[model samples]
Target: MDSALAVRALDESTWAAFAELVEANNGVWGGCWCVGFHVKLGKGRTAAQNRAEKEQRVRDGETHAALVFDGDRCLGWCQFGSPDELPEIKSRRLYEKGLTTLPDWRITCFFTGKGLRGRGVADAALGGAIAEISRLGGGVVEGYPEETDDRKVSGSFLHTGPMAAFEKHGFTRTRPISPHRWVVTRTVA
Candidate 1:
């Protein structure tokens, strides 16, 4: 069997697939719709309200993420955008230390479905995300993959992805901001 991957912008036509990926793997990130790190964090807003706000971002062409697909099926997702584009990240307790606002594109989170875990889906998504950002005219792409001594960390908190996973895709940790988070970045050349 062949596995051809396609990465695209999150738009109206792709909304359902995006929603399906979140719903099908609620345990992965609690049916987040991938907005917790972009809209819900520290906002004190209900999930529904956060979802609504995030949906408006997509509609307003202000989305900072992309969904990954294996052919016609949505299998993974990556959240990337300018720091200013993501309110949740900016509002986090570690925001100042975890992120650097230097006109860079940030990859704050990633989620691949249960059946697709450990299958290089995240790597493919990362590559595709790089290409997406590069095609839009090259900028620094940053990630904050969680580092754990135990490999058994659950996907819910592993949304940042594994540090090894990011390293495999050319991301290098510039600094360690916390015990669980490290700031990683790749400057497109």
Candidate 2:
């Protein structure tokens, strides 16, 4: 809620914060790190393998998203990278129609701690991701958000942030990849 809250690129110091943010809020995916989709769908690595590789990537400063912080604490997580940066997303059916060479930034994942949910943490992260991408230079931003009919909270939901939430952040439906999946986009102009 504080406009002074800042979103900074994922860094080593913030790595623990990012992990803490997820573990404190959503334990299932948080426990494994944001490597589930990337590992299973992209690299086909075991969970332990994925964990080690992700850790190495962070150590190597190859992070592709920004961590949301309120003062010194990390409160949320968002993943952004050029489509090419995430080979797993391209291998998935949901992104089949999205052009790979367009130099687009894809928001493939997000997580907010339980106490921070419904408090606009995700909106701030999305805004921060867009700004980060735009700051680097205007590029198409894509996100696949889940279509939820009733705004009910579910503990099982992870990956693919809420469609309405993305819409609220200025993302529009670019395509309906499935009954519950929609590809949303916001072109920086």
Best by TM-score: 1
lDDT digits (tens) for residues 53-128 of candidate 1: 6678788878856678887788887888876775455225664754446547888778888788766677777777
Angstrom error at residue 15, model 2 = 1.9
- Using all chains and alpha carbons, the TM-scores for the candidates as numbered come to 0.84, 0.81
Clashing pairs in 2: 25-113, 25-114
Model 1, residue 68: distance off in Å is 1.6
Per-residue CA lDDT of candidate 2, range 76-188, in tens?
86788775565555226755765454436788888776667666677788888888888878678888788887766573464668887788878889777777777788887
Candidate 2 lDDT at 45 equals 44
The alpha-carbon lDDT assigned to residue 84 of candidate 2 equals 59
- C-alpha local distance difference test of each model: 0.72, 0.70
Clash counts for the predictions, in order: 0, 2
TM-score of 1: 0.84
The true-versus-predicted C-alpha distance at residue 49 of model 2, in Å, is: 3.7
